[model samples]
Target: MNSLYHGSELCEVDADGNVAVPAFLEDAFAPETSPEIVVAKHQADDCLIGYGRAHLSTLAERAERRRVAEEERGEEARSHYRRMRGTFGLSERIKRDGRGLRIPPAMRHLGRIDDLALFVGAGDSFEIWNPQLALESDDEHFRALAEFRLRMRGTKTAGVH
Candidate 1:
């Protein structure tokens, strides 16, 4: 069975932008093959999404199928190109270093992450959020979780004096 990621962990992002993958999520990664995870900006959210390499394979397969289908229609595949760019093009395959997985500068800017990242599992994938931005999320669960965790960490959310 494929790995199912569920649970949340708060991690510190060091100066080099490395954030340790939570221990609970370690089993989901196939370290023997490659110690990498794909991090991408969530299309509709102000956060980053993460998944194992296997999920990247699945995405490639789906993209290929879409490409083939577009060819069969005897029409330009602009949609396919757009989708690919939005998905694969914007993603970064980051390897795990000694400290942890390094969040590339571009992705770091895209996700607005700094100092602290709150990892929340979303079944097949997980989310990387800047705890401060998470506090503004419309999703009550995420907002509350971020709030609770920040308090536990003795960190105060901005404008929350």
Candidate 2:
């Protein structure tokens, strides 16, 4: 499974809505075997999700597995399966040119993306967010992050008596 992504990085969105992806993540898309990328709504968060061909396929497979298993269960499970299927279908593939990949309209609106966006690296997928929204979310997000760290820190004595 792809690890959950976190944090933010600044990136420019061009006139045509294309944005350059961070070079560090280029390899993740290689499995997709296409320069084209897909942008869609993130299920659990207020952000835009980006997927390469391979990653999308992996997501499809997982959804399919859930669907098949749900089929054996009943109506409720089936409904969930249908919803998952529907979500995958909403994905839009981005076209790459000399500049970068263009963000699709649906995703653009969903993320409120404009001239500038913040690309956040999540292990298996990345999220694109409008700069202002990102800034607002970061305050709350970072506070939670700090709390998490504090909980995880081991207590130690500063000095011996």
**Model 1 lDDT per residue over 19-121, tens place:** 8878767766655646778899987789998887778878778899989988998868898888788788889999877537899999999999999999988
lDDT of 2 at 92: 82
Mind giving the per-residue lDDT tens digits that candidate 2 earns over 10-118? 5677766777765545544544356676788877667788866557668767777877787776636756655674467657877655436788777787878877766
Candidate 1 clashing pairs, residues 3+ apart or interchain: none
- For all candidates in order, the CA lDDT equals 0.84, 0.63
Least accurate stretch of 10 residues (summed lDDT) in model 1? Answer: 24-33
Error of 1 at 101 (Å): 1.5
User: Per-prediction RMSD in angstroms?
Assistant: 2.9, 9.2
Clashing pairs in 2: 5-122, 32-54
Per-residue error for 120 in candidate 2, Å, reads 1.0
Residue 108 of model 2: what lDDT? Answer: 82
C-alpha positional error of residue 5 in candidate 1 after TM-score superposition, expressed in Å: 1.2
